[model samples]
Target: MPDHQQRIAYLLARYVNKTCSREELEELFAMIGQENGPDIPGDLLEEIWHTAHPAPDIDYEQAYLHIKPVVPIRRSLPFRKIAVAASVLLLAGAGYWWLSAEKKTAQITTVQSAPAPPILPAGNKAVLTLADGSTVTLDSAGNQVISQGKVAIRQSNGQLLYAGQPTDGSIHYNKLTTPRGGQFRLVLPDGTKVWLNSASMLRYPTVFSGKERIVELDGQGYFEVAPDAQHPFKVKVHDIEVQVLGTTFDIMAYRDEQSVNTTLLTGSIRVNKGSVQQLLQPGQQAVANNQDQQLAVRAADLRKVTAWKNGMFVFNDMALPAILREVARWYDVDIVYNTSPATELYGGGIGRDLQLADVLALLEGNGLNHFRIEGRKVIVLP
Candidate 1:
């Protein structure tokens, strides 16, 4: 084998074993985008399938098909080998993670020339507002601990973890805000885990005070309560409040969105809007209309509901405008409609790690609408 091919194989193996670093992932993907990226040996792929276990919710065959059109895949060889190999070794936990689908497909967009620089995907980035209103920038490149009183706030591995007990019993509120083109993970002092999406803010006390552990979220966030039966965990957003003893759920209360949705995953939660309260069971979602603030219940699409937290954009028959709204948030771009919003519904998903152009191209390939990029704005054409 050639030197480049050997290197590719090594990187591919490292990727499958889940040891590839961010720089290595960038290199591997650069090779994938190359004109003559080398193919992996079929035998090596077979070995990979036999040894490595695949990640959950991955349809390797579908993902392989998505990549085969653009990447080098020889039809002369058996399809099963390539598909199985991709299924087993192409774990997306690393940066080399590409598009995988559950019976979905992807077509790599062809670029003719550069109109502007690529808009990259969001990473672990946010702003931490201290109790005194002081601010600190936190990103994936940062790994440090910020001391505020007795609580030790550690930023590591793209997540903010709070350690130690608060010395003073007085409540101190700290806010973590992720601007456009950013996302963040946080562990509260009470051990509750929060994954904040792009263009979102989470405000909470440094310590769980009194009888309730309450936090305020301004956008979308996934929460896994610390299982405290003694102190009930509460989430307040706008006019709605979610009350729970201990539960796993997601709340999307973006003001721009038509409705505020609270999806329950593991435990039960009560969605309170004034005197009206709706209880949500596991696998159920409560939708509160923005205009009337009326709460409605429906079965939740678990995968699509939590796709962002899992590093994917799994849309399940979502309308074109709704999908574009999400894309805009992740890529930190403004969507200007040159024409009326299309009523088309789309399915399937792609990796959140892909670029904005790539994502737009994938969506355009569905023949929904033509998209043009102008600086930070994405203009839609009919």
Candidate 2:
């Protein structure tokens, strides 16, 4: 309940919410060392150390100052109480907004540390599972053709394509799955470009010969839908449906994700969930959750959302947990935290190709958090 602990909690919430400047971070660090520095739990110390350091190439002072401060909140509560209370309030607010006419707030925070897992190499490859249960693994080694009545499967250019001649009266579906630590790309018969992130699956028909081209998804995928004014491309993500005629967008519809985010890069599209239909323009993102009746639209930075496809890990004021999620996907590893970190922000750059240690080394540069990699698990210490 000391003022130092309260300030740390306040800053922790701010960092997780993607708002905290470098000068503020430096001030916080100095304050931590002065008063409650030793009071910080041992397990959380590693996370704190990681956040302070971020990466070896970073100018901590500059990176910290470049980021913005989040909306100010009352910071007088005890650290533990604030953590529990904030999470509870956030959950309740999201739930309450789902069934009422009240407007929902676009704020989020988490109590977690730096997310660097054991570096993992990309796995063999991914496979396309036909409706008849036949599988086709894609790579440069070999390419084969598989037919399930009418669809043709081709593996070329490191991608699996489902190109088929259309037939009236009947429809056939095919599935693409990427295993743990693996990822793949695919082009639907209708020219829809899909980049499936690791551990993702997409189910679509062989042909878009119907009134609407609909697909089901699990995990994350970025799509560039081919233009067809008359026939719209509808993506069924859980209960939400993203309808687009021709546009470039990204959809993070992973089941484990708290919300399905549909970020539009170009053109126009409509996101619908039952009675709720929200129109989106370029540079806009629509977030739909199971608890909400409608999709929430907001401005977004396309680069940050699609950084994985571009072969980088860009954290523009991201929380420790969210950052870890990206690391887990790319490295194909699990994360275990022994403690929560002192509220600090991580602002810098790291490539996806870097070794896991290199990434952690950067985080440790902050001198607040520490990390250890054990097999496929990353144990974070404060």
Candidate 3:
């Protein structure tokens, strides 16, 4: 078997033995249904079954055949990967599927999908505001290069790239803004890459002429800075500034959010806010409180922090209001609450590419609250 398949087999064994870690379980779910991979062999499946059951009388072939007729696995499974993994666990007699058919039926009967509002996912859309006050609509702009003195700006393959160095010593700044329900990627002149989330703005100079390269951000952005020991890259988000020589990090500093977060993925970063400064290693996060002007550093779940860039919404004990705030930005919808919900925390991962109705449906299935979508507004009811 291939190395990846072998790894998967090993993971399956660990899973059946109830020894798989949360990260390993997530990896196993991600690998399911991956294309160009061989189907799990029967021998491995049998081993997994016996590891979980530990009974010699329970025949794997008979159990699989019995479930095959009832489950009906066609050429393609008409279910999400999480759902499939749940089914597999149930087949192994680990436990009942978390999303059982009875619960789904009850949810369907209570919530009607046809009348809900339909909001499409965000796309590669942003507006470039030049230094001269002229604007370029990136989504509608064709494959054409615009020149600002010696600097060349162009959009290709859904990414905005900057090439050619500035001739003169003068620096001209440009701004890229992504409205609600939009996102964009940009390549700075120093070969650094940035991913801008919805309702965010980035302001940067056309060239790096000074001792330090600095950029200002209004909302959230992920940075893959190019290595330059002499000229460190700095991102200023509101009151906090993140300094790095060459590192990958994400900064969340939305005006509406109470705190500014800087999560370091690779390399190291120095976060500064007022007189407070914190150095972050890999898998660490620095949070700056807007009101108290205090900086706190803690270990971070990198997957949850960077999930937005990977086309998913990952929550780790996230509050209801916080999740709704993200949903509002991504779907470009206003949220109205009839009654304030109790302090509720949720943890899960869902595809950000799904439609707003689909995402809301998943939330509604929990039966904790009701949602009514009217046009571009999502009304929350207790």
Candidate 4:
């Protein structure tokens, strides 16, 4: 095997073992869809499959059929040896298939362009505001424990946790804010865990008191509310209120969006807006339209709704403007359109951890829209 092919094999093995670094993962995916790239050896793929699944009767054709429904195949890219290798490995229960899917179909189209600086993905970073009007910049490097009265707060491995119980019967509120190109995970006093997406703000109590536990949210958040039957948990986002005793749900209430969406993953939630209210079950979504104040319920694709929380941007027949809005928020860049393309819809999921160049290339490759990155701004061209 040649040097490049050998490297691919090594990376594939490392990826199968869940030991590849982020940079290695990116390089592997970039090479997978190369039009004329070197072929991955069939024996190497068979070895990987046998090692991972030990099943002698497993049929590759049947396995591919199982994946065809869920795994998207890019019609633009030629079916290469890497695709076959991916199919075999995925059938053997390798987790690398998910990462590979993000890059397989996002090939950039040919375009004359200047080499613009790359914009990296957002990370676990945020600003925490205490009740005393003090702010702490939270990052992965900090290991300090901060105490305010009876409540203690600390960050470990990018997740902020609260220790100690509230005994003073006094309520103290703290706000966690993630700027553009940033995200954060927080554990509230009541053990409820929250994952805040980019450009989002969550105002929560340091310790629960009174009759109900309530929090105010602006922007997007995925919450796993701690079950407290007596003290119901309620989230207030704009004009909508989501009440649940215990459940996992996602709320998208960005000001730029036309409606507030609440996607329930487990348990049940009551979505209320003014006099309009609707109950949502698992796998269901409640949309509250801002214009008519009407609440609508529909079955939802949970994977697409919570893709951001899972480190992917899944767009399903999404509009161009909506897609650009998400790209701008996650990359912390401004978007300007010189001429809008005719109405276009996109369907695919890309890794949110990819650089702006890779993502823009995917968009351009689909022949949907063209973009030019200038400094911190992306300009759409005719």
lDDT tens readout by residue for model 4, 285-380: 999987888999999978788889878887655677888899999999999998976375544556787777767765654344677777898888
Query: TM-score of every model?
Result: 0.73, 0.68, 0.73, 0.73
Reference-based lDDT, each prediction:
0.76, 0.64, 0.75, 0.77
On lDDT, the stronger of 1 and 2 is: 1
Task: Report how far off residue 267 is in candidate 4 (Å).
Answer: 0.3
What is the alpha-carbon lDDT for the whole of candidate 2?
0.64
The digit string of per-residue lDDT tens for model 2 on 284-308 reads: 9998876767578899967678876
Question: Model 4: runs farther than 4 Å from truth?
Answer: 1-116
Give per-candidate clash totals: 0, 21, 0, 0
Error of 2 at 4 (Å): 26
User: What's model 1's TM-score?
Assistant: 0.73
Query: What TM-score does structure 4 among the candidates reach?
Result: 0.73
Q: List the residue pairs that clash in candidate 3.
A: none
Runs in model 3 deviating more than 4 A are: 1-117
